[model samples]
Target: MLREIYLSTALLAAFGLVGAGLVALVHMGTAERIEANREAATLARLHEILPDGEYDNDIINDTTVLSHALLGGGQHLVYRARRNDEPVAAVFTVIARGGYSGDIHLLVGVRENGQVAGVRVISHRETPGLGDDIEASRSDWILGFDNLALDDPPMERWAVQRDGGIFDQFTGATITPRAVVRAVRDTLIYFDTHREQVFTPIPVDPTDEEAHADE
Candidate 1:
């Protein structure tokens, strides 16, 4: 009886090790493919926010990470676009954490002129019928953000109508829209103040970036 138990335990451990090894092998084999697929998906989303012809550089590879309180206090990726060796716009992935259900991720493209190139919701867990209206497929409400800037909306009016802003709030949902508006507003502000930093070339280093002053 005791011998039987030991045998079963030994078999289980051996199987577990084999399973782990298999998983490791599969991960190693598919790692690059998985990463490529992810990059393709991200590029698709980026194109939605800032379509082709908007810039003449590889936006995907021209990126830098930004960590700012205005951007939800988390590390976020900023993709820069340039044309003829001059920066055109900066695309940011910002988070709206006051959504009705949970955090809402947004990809916002702000032109060098301070105008918004476009905005797209990357992900969210808001109510399907109400808060979800922020999505392009669900409704064109988000389209209202195109060409917008801090001055366009007037900084003071960067909130849902219910909150005395020019933006319209959903019939039954205000929290979601309000959250999105605030996040977009903050993102624009950050980009405006840190335009050079936001559009820093790929693999930005703090001391190296400050060298812009000499150049």
Candidate 2:
């Protein structure tokens, strides 16, 4: 009986190890494909917000990280768009807090002159029919932000119309639209304050240094 118990324990341990190893192998196999899909989705959103042809450089490769309270206080990726090496616009992946259900993820593009290029909702948990109108597929409301600037609306009028602003709020979901409006405004302010830093070139890699040294 003692020998049988030991054998059972050994088989269980071996099975556990095999299961773990299989999981690791599956993860390793899918890792690149998963990352590639994520990158493609992100690039699609970027193009939707910033538009194609307006940028010549590889926007995905030319990016910088920004962390600020206005940007939801977490490190956010800022993709800079340029034509012929001149800055065209900067697209920010920002988080909108205070949503009705939860946070709303956004992609806001601002031109070099401070005007808003466009805005797109990357993801959100707002009410399907009401707050979901903030999405381009659901409504044209998001397009109202195009070409707007901090001064054009006088900044204070950036809120939803219910709050004495130029934007509109969903009939049954004011919090979600309000949250998105505030977040977009904050993102513009963040970009305005850090335009220079946003466009700053990324540092060289050590591997590149080694390759150059080889020459």
Candidate 3:
């Protein structure tokens, strides 16, 4: 009986180790491809936001922080677009949490002058026909936010058409579109307010160097 228990335990351990090894091998093989795909996608989105010229990579601080200008949700990735060593605009990922089903990720570009250059939906799990209209494929409604400035007597001009503003919401899907509009508006406002801080260079901490060395 003792011998049988020992054999059973050994087999379970061996199986567990094999499973872990397979998972590790798969991850190791796929890591590069996954990273390449991510980089390509990021560059494509950055180009859409800043179509004029090339941009160099700029890192934000270590702490993941969201902008208050975000309306429906928050800011994710922030990149500073540059031309001739001068910062032209800051592109950041914004999310709209009030989508028909859930959060809708959006890539937003705000110029130094506080105008929205462009926006693109990165990903979402919204309903097929109804909420999908937020995508560029279903409709060109999302493109309407391009070149909108945050000036004038009031920024209320950026609201949805149903709210007596410039943008138009989907026929039946008002909440999804409305949330996106608000998010874009808020992002622009946040950019205008935190222009200096966002454009500043991120300082590298010495502790990070030690951590990397340990790795």
Clashes of each: 0, 0, 2
Among the numbered candidates, top TM-score falls to 2
Q: How far is candidate 2 from the true structure (C-alpha RMSD, Å)?
A: 3.4
Which parts of model 1 have CA positions greater than 4 angstroms off?
Answer: 1-26, 203-215
Q: Report the C-alpha lDDT of model 3 over 1-215, residue by residue, as the tens digit.
A: 99999999999999999999999999988998898898777776677778644455442222234555353444466777665656778877788777778888888888877878888898988778887888887888888888777763257776777898777777788888888887787787778777887777557789999999999
> Candidate 1's error at 64, in angstroms?
0.7
Q: Write the per-residue lDDT of candidate 2 for residues 1-215, one digit (tens) a residue.
A: 99999999999999999999999999998998999998898888887887778889999899988999999888998899999989999999899999999999998999999999999998998888889999999999999999999888988899999999999888999999899899989988888888899899789999999999999
Reference-based lDDT, each prediction: 0.90, 0.91, 0.75
lDDT of 1: 0.90
Q: TM-score: which is higher, 1 or 2?
A: 2
Number of the predicted model whose lDDT against the real structure is largest? 2
Residue pairs whose backbone atoms clash in candidate 1? none
lDDT value, candidate 2, whole model = 0.91
List, residue by residue over 1-215, the lDDT tens digit for candidate 1. 99999999999999999999999999987998899999999889888878868799988888889999899888998899899869988889999889999999999889999999898999999998999999999999999999998898789999898888999999899999999999999999898789878766665588887898679
In model 1, the worst 10-residue window by lDDT is 196-205
TM-score of each: 0.81, 0.84, 0.74
lDDT of model 2, residue 166: 92
